[model samples]
Target: MKLFNWPNIRLVLMFSLVVFLFSFTSNRNSQRKVAKSTVIFVGNIDPFINQETVNKLLIENNQDPQSIGKDKLDLNKLEKSLNGHEMIEKSDVFVSIDGILKAVVKQKTPIARVFNNGHSFYIDYEGNTMPLSDNFTARVPLVSGEINKKNKEDLADLFRIIYDDAFLKKNIIGAQIMPNGSLLMFNRNFNYQIDFGRIMNLEHKFKNYKAFFQKAVLDSSLYKYKIIDLRFSQQVVCTK
Candidate 1:
């Protein structure tokens, strides 16, 4: 082929460089657009956890996920804040790629009320103390006694045992605490008392009650009895 023209060669090289540079610039701009539009996904957040509260906490500490150079979001702190409320038993928080935050909350369920010395407190099924509400009425067992500061734990334990026992819980109408720290249960039918002491080996004591009631009380014409003692290990004593 004839010797290539220098001017034409220079023009061809310049066109090639221009095309390469344009493509490189376009790719860089595209990449930057994608980076700016990056989103995060968060889930499992309760609706009750206000978005404004989360924003405030995040902004105060410069922990917002959306902010450049901001500290990573502290999941533990967020969860603690949500769970600190008396009404919330459990809570979860989630962050989305699109900078959305989600929160979910589980409310405490009260199963019974403990009346001690005049002040009343609610006990949940899981043996946790729940704040009493005037608007809410629960048809659970009522426990009353000469309760002191030390007696609260014992009362909570008693509630836990009773709630776990299906047979005794169904039959129990209410519970009373004797001066000796013993528990007296009131049944739905017939004015009788069940002496369940301190709730040690509760499952075993409950089983004993079931066996005795099925054999002696259910079949017998004795619908009325004075007291049924389930305090003894593996034995039930009835006083008529």
Candidate 2:
């Protein structure tokens, strides 16, 4: 009986050779030069920043892209650069064993574009203000007027409501914050604007509007009036 078969010996030798080659390649690549960086955008966001910009950021932050050692690189610093970008919400940076550097970036979700105090910016889903991007413009609803700490949450909720509702998203093109903490939405279908006063009891307010809209649409009287008011406690008010 053979203690060790020829097939087993061949398999063992092949494995040893593979391991040796991997080790040799790894050692050689230990003094790795990061190749051109790859930018991966996560999610369905229309990227506010492009791959070229991301690569530029990486190059600038990497200190010396020509440096021959991934270990010598402060990868965290590179990641920080991407994270600090106004349009970027979060990011991950890493180098493959083959010296390919990949940067995964998640862009901030802009729920509404705000025009306040003669300045324009984007308001993210988290209610944080994000700087406008020169590369791309978000198609989210436009919002104008002043905001205070008291009505910010209510306003944020309104933005979310518009974003989440298909009919509202399609119909509401813009919004205005009133002095009395009410919201006014621009109508896309009709010439009239919606005075959606406060977001309190939002569900009922929307239900009232939806019902009224459906009724108005049925009789072809949608264009007869201006301004749909949904603020007076579960009632739909309109004027000609």
Candidate 3:
């Protein structure tokens, strides 16, 4: 009986019309063609890979996607390819409703540069090795002389400590491994060497050095010493 009600039928028809219009609009938008593609390197990307490099990578993979159908472009594959780059830590590829293909990438950061034998390369913060870039050289702490691959983690940790302390980072320029497996540190501002010995007791050694340096600075005797030994426990030994 109520199935013929005028108001109910009118409301149902209006709802159906709105639903049909929304579906039509969505389908039309989904089929729109891609107009352009853009690559964005998000973090610390300079001196490594640039926009042109990323664009070339896309072209190589045939994923340039300019003027192509948005629905046909494979964004997942684009991301996968970008992530495969050694310098790229992570990447995200996506397309907007206006058919603009975009990729955002994150770059890896290096903590130390190593010179072993005749080869030179960078060691990332995670202890991973990275190739040097001809465009720019990172001003991180240099590791020369003999380098032991077995102590990679220790080297990484030493760099991290230097990076965290602004005073030490600015003063300490390089390090070397002696024949006895001991370590020696050099400062840019001072002509003397720091006999760091082994990598252990870093916190205690740096503290002793800091205290001794403060005293030496007051007496204008910092440059007079040639070697400041921090190998002993809770003591600093200096030689001229």
Candidate 4:
């Protein structure tokens, strides 16, 4: 049998230690490079969520990747922070390898102006009540009369008619809600009144108005008529 050599065992142990040290040093250098090159991408963020705010929050919360030795920045917390604002509709965030941040934002679009009691609010396309801003003016039809409670569905339906029905939208300047829940439309150009009751079968009613206007008003000199009542189904009454 060959004899076991103590010096040979020591040499082998030393070589293994050297290899481990080299690997550890290489890993440390790779980590350092990654830490030096990191960038952040922030999307759907407004000017309110500026660079200073981001820097302050990150530094205050100790969320900076460089401070924590992280390969990627945690954008979830940043997004949550931005979404806390009432004006922010949506926000997205991104990060690059060089530690730079990019942000993009989408804002809510108002569809109509809603008034209740003495205060006024904007109704967006989605029928959500948006607080009026001093910086921007909403270019939408005004609604008034007995609007005390929230009526998103009714308001949305009215907006749909305004957007889809071309002739009616052009002719109608404003809408009023009666105490008994009937809808009244006023024409600005013609100085006529349209009594649209309770929005039921509105599509059919609007179609009838189109046909009646083309045949009765446009074809003849009936613009002098004061009221065009289409509240009753299958009939249109014009008063001079």
**Each prediction's whole-model lDDT (CA):** 0.65, 0.83, 0.81, 0.64
Off by over 4 Å in 1: 1-77, 97-100, 220-222
Better of 1 and 4 by TM-score: 4
On residues 36-79, what C-alpha lDDT tens digit does candidate 4 reach at each position? 32223343222323344444544317645455433345568766
Task: Estimate, for each residue in 150-216, the C-alpha lDDT of model 2 and write its tens digit.
Answer: 7777777878887889988787789988887778888787899888877688878887888899889
Q: Write the per-residue lDDT of candidate 3 for residues 1-240, one digit (tens) a residue.
A: 698699999999999999999999888877888777788777676668777777666653464567567777777877788888877778888888787878888877777889999999888867788888867788888888666676777878888888778888888888997777778999888899999998887778888888888788888899899999999996899999
Better of 1 and 3 by TM-score: 3
For model 3, the superposed segments whose C-alpha errors exceed 4 Å read: 1-18, 146-149
Candidates sorted on TM-score, descending: 3, 2, 4, 1
Error of 2 at 155 (Å): 1.5
Model 1 gets an lDDT of 0.65
Question: Which stretches of model 2 miss by more than 4 angstroms?
Answer: 1-26, 60-62
Best by TM-score: 3
Candidate 1 residue lDDT tens string, 1-240? 545788889988999999999998665543331111121124322242344443443332553444432124566776787577664577676554434555555656666677877788777756677777544566668888775667766666666666667766677779888888878888887677898887467668878877887887657634657898888895788888
Query: Clashes in candidate 4: how many?
Result: 25
